[model samples]
Target: MLFGAESNLDLALALYDLGGVQFGDFDLGPTAGRSPIYLNPRVLISDPAVLRRIALLIHHEIQADQARRRPRLASFAAVAGVPMGGLHLATAYALVSDTPLLYVRPDSQQPSIEGRIIPGQTVLVIDDLMTGGTSLLRTAKALEESGLVVRDFIVLIDREQGGTERLHEHGYHVMPILRLRTMLTYYHECGLLDTARYRTVMDYLERTSPRRWSGSP
Candidate 1:
């Protein structure tokens, strides 16, 4: 689903202004590899205004999806934030929407989930970004184990990697507010990103994208 162009641009600018979007040769751990661009929405927490805007954007998107009768996202009874980064967004969303919030705490011998875990309750998984989807999948597995149902996953930004496809293969749906490619294009068009930097990030995304290139590099 596409958000309004103005809203998208505003969000892109806000992310860049907040230092959430960075251009560099940063390491993305072993699984995700290196990239020319990196997005860290965790910075949103440092700015309450931006964080609230983000939460509202998510809330609106979910409402729009429900209005369109997208059952997977429309039928969720609660929201679950994928730990560490996602918890903050989930908390803000829960506060705004009055929806029950859930999270898994796998820090103990008997790992368990927080919030009211009614069996068979549908949960919408929330996260800041998507790379290979390992964290989201793990969170979903934990939720399912606790008798909660998970079908819809939402993120602020999608890295345009294999994350969405990977989750789809596992029968889960992903909804990203902004895609890295789209943001890059916007930035370049608006002069926020130079031509060279734009091309570099675009090329990097294509080469590392599982959809374009087979197997991990």
Candidate 2:
């Protein structure tokens, strides 16, 4: 169990219940050709109880990492969320943890980070999902440009499509609450997902995984 069995299963079931996990052919833009399962954490926003559960899980993960003396658990002054989907999760986490929240506006004429702009502050980046790692990188760049340090990222779900690897290559630590494979397996075992869909997602993940997979949790 990479991220704990009970909690991961709970979140997976919650996502399924909230209709966040859809099984079908989905166009994931140019970077991700096609995906059998589409994870939309944004749906959690409509369910505050589940969203708070997620925030608690993320907070617990950070506390656990700090307890283990993980090097990437360096003290961060604030939590920055990637725009659109990530912002909502970040906001929930911030509210529950009593931490300041920040966000980046990459599409602006002059891209900038919102919230208290404090130079030399370390920030924990948050996002709803990780696919190609493009959004996280862009947000990190924006924060760095604004004199903030970003060394660790917290994503609700990792699609396992090289996003974590790509972020690792750039010297960033990613902590995902749940992996797509784990969620799919949990769903299938719980009778929420049919065998055909489970196999489809597993094959998709295997085919799109990095060539030199290190199998990091």
What is candidate 1's lDDT per residue for 63-148, written digit by digit as tens? 77778844547488899998879889999999999999999886756648999999999999999989989999999999999999
The parts of candidate 2 lying over 4 Å away from their true place are: 1-4, 212-217
Across 112-213, the per-residue lDDT of candidate 2 in tens digits comes to: 778998899999999999998999999999999999999999999998889988999999989888888888888888888899878988988887788536
Using alpha carbons, what is the TM-score of model 1?
0.92
- Give the count of colliding residue pairs in each prediction: 0, 0
